[model samples]
Target chain A: MADRPPVRDWATDFDHTDPTWVADPYPIWDELRQACPVAHSDRYGGAWLPTRHADVAAIAYDTDDFTSRSVVVTEYRPPNLAPRGIAPPITSDPPFHQGARRMLLPLMSPQVIAKWEPSTREYCQSLVHELAGREVVDAATEYAQHIPVRVIARMLGFPEDDADRFRGFVHHVLEDVTLPLELRLPGMQELFEYLRDQVKDHIDNPRDDLTTALLNADMGGEVADLSHVGGTIALLLLAGIDTTWSAIGASIWHLASHPEDRDRLVKEPDLLPTAVEEFLRAYAPVTMARLVKHDMDWHGCPMKEDDWILLSFPAANRDPEFFVDPDEVIIDRTDNRHAAFGLGIHRCAGSHLARMELRVALEVFLDAFPVFHLDDPAAVKWSAGQVRGPRTLPVHIG
Target chain B: MVKIAIDSERCEGHGRCYSLAPKLVEPDDLGNGRVIGDGTVPADQEDNARQAEGNCPERAVLLEET
Candidate 1:
């Protein structure tokens, strides 16, 4: 057995699971960036938290040293997990990652996703219409979460009948960060089983969905088993469902707290695209992990093999080294290279789709309830871990 | 006479070039952009095309005027 590195004291010890960090990570992030750019955390069996944009971008680009093979920032590894790994592209590196990505690329491509834009517009508008009679709506639960799951499900060619179930599976795996990975493994296993059945069905029946496209793809070669396909679909669901909603929820949260911005958006609707970009940057959603492949000196910190390092895209967005006013949310901020969806080879495959969803969602939302505000500011609840956003936001929808 | 070009390798698919100057930059199937047509930037749309070049995150787009 390979010996684990001895634990050492560090300047900044971030406990991601802690509620304090979950609620408002910016203060701690600032402390770490100023004091310890490469701070270590003892929570997930000693993980490193990098608060600098350059360091995070370098690590992402240096796939050779910091691999995506084991992205979860924990020492926990299940014996039953496949040697090929949990999810393709996201979990894969180089040759394998490239091939797998090519196969999945068209699903979210401009032409393909453009075909779904009308329906996407319809979905967002319809959801807003449904909330017309409500006095107070939990905008996060009511609005932000509605459109993405259905759109992703339809795009993947999954039966619309089970879209709710699909959302349930996503919440179980991604949002259920209240418990450790050990406890969450059971739910993960269940999701894998469900995805496995879905992939098997696609293989046997041969539908005209994204699954069929992936099933018959010539990706330099082929996956040995259908389980790999199942893994890939599972990965999509994991990546797809929660991420955009977090941004959407955070957008509502931001607008609710800052009515001036909301009023401006309502008055000058043309600014929606720029507002979306700023929202993506200011409340950048996803934080990804990369495993240290070899024991080496990273910047000033002595990183060891198998140690986890969180490349906080949110933190990177606020990196004072790059942006002029890192903390302030400038809606029309140009020259913005924020890593909201991340960077490097494994940048979000569904980014175009995500951008479209956010734009349409906000556009319809502003049009539908231009005068809405948070009913109880104190009651807004946020979800922490991997994907972060407002889980519960009660708004007075006029 | 001039044509625009982009080194696709550097494209992180920011889509700014296309969004800013759609006449010059066209998005490929997955929304990663490329210079449209023989990559020609017409005289009327030259300023829009230049803005796109300035805004691309990866500096992928290139414009040459002769």
Candidate 2:
């Protein structure tokens, strides 16, 4: 992470990487929603943060005004890579977006994702089993972090032991966005190199996994190109890891702190599904970004072409206008039309897979511990960037 | 009596409708919501149908009273 000045005013100068925003951003977002619904910053070369659900949704849906050329706010603005940007679908726009997205949607749909549940559950159970006799456990590292890495690795047919390298890739792409182009570009290059190697391996072996599926994926009667395959693989690997990892870690962190929710869930196991949704709504892990297509007045904020729009679904989920008692985490709360996964075209392709991982991880953890709490409240450290969650979560299970 | 319909144009496959009311709606190959069996909601399952309609983030789920 790069060092920078602390945020003076969240409304005028909001930096997502700022310690104030990273530590506890809900209050900052709450204040911004009322005072400045769309906050602007000179950091990251003129970025705008839209705190309202309507604004964020409008931006997400308006493919015409905001381009998905680059979803990450970094010093280096990726050259116009629309339709099939650095990562397809997630970074693609309009007609091109739908096709690229459709190719992968079936692979992640509920029915398809359902088949992985058994394996995911087994993996989670094994993780829990490892921590059986431990009095204190780092859920983030030991339990929550490993689940997604293992699952995604198996799906991609990559070496499962290379989890550390994947985390390094995640940190560079997501957490280290504030770094200079010289530093950031190399990390991205390394990631692509890794994907290329994996793609080569899949080609040689032709195994049953996402890499093979993507390589052989049809693009309107034409096979997807090499770069597209590698990019899509990059998307699957990078997107799948930290986002779900954060969701699982945050959910466990919540349970560790809030025994009431934990006990309720432990007693009535059926409530886990609803509670999972609630956790996603309240502590939604992913916040996406978009680049302004043309200079235009956006809700009184003078936005320039190529200005970064932090399309914060997290902020949108907490918008009082959209959610009842927006800040409160009600386990069984229905009518939760939250934009946790996002809205419109670019809804997380791996949402079903993520949901499965989260539900299973929580289920295994609660079943193993039954009763747990934060070992040290002050010790929990949240990762600073778009994907926010506790990186180091210490809990006492005994 | 009520019948359910999903606007394909609006449905982005969030799976909320199908998740909430599986009997009334189900996900297609692409995970978009599809009304099951003539899209009709039984008297007993009307609440589930309505819940699905209201909870759809895209507002794609439609319930028509007949």
- DockQ of each candidate, alpha-carbon based: 0.46, 0.81
Q: Which stretches of candidate 1 lie over 4 Å from their true place?
A: A1-10, A78-84, A177-182, A221-225, B1-4, B38-47, B50-55, B62-66
- Model 1 C-alpha lDDT per residue in residues A110-190, reported as the tens digit of each score: 667777889999999989989998899999888998778888888778877887788788777665654556778887878
Candidate with maximal lDDT: 2
Candidate 2 ranges beyond 4 A from true positions: none
Q: Over the stretch A288-322, how does candidate 2's per-residue lDDT look in tens digits?
A: 99999999998788989999999999999999999
Alpha-carbon interface RMSD of model 1?
A: 2.3
Instruction: Report the first chain's TM-score for all candidates.
Output: 0.93, 0.98
Candidates in order have lDDT scores of 0.78, 0.90
Clashes of each: 3, 0
lDDT of 1: 0.78
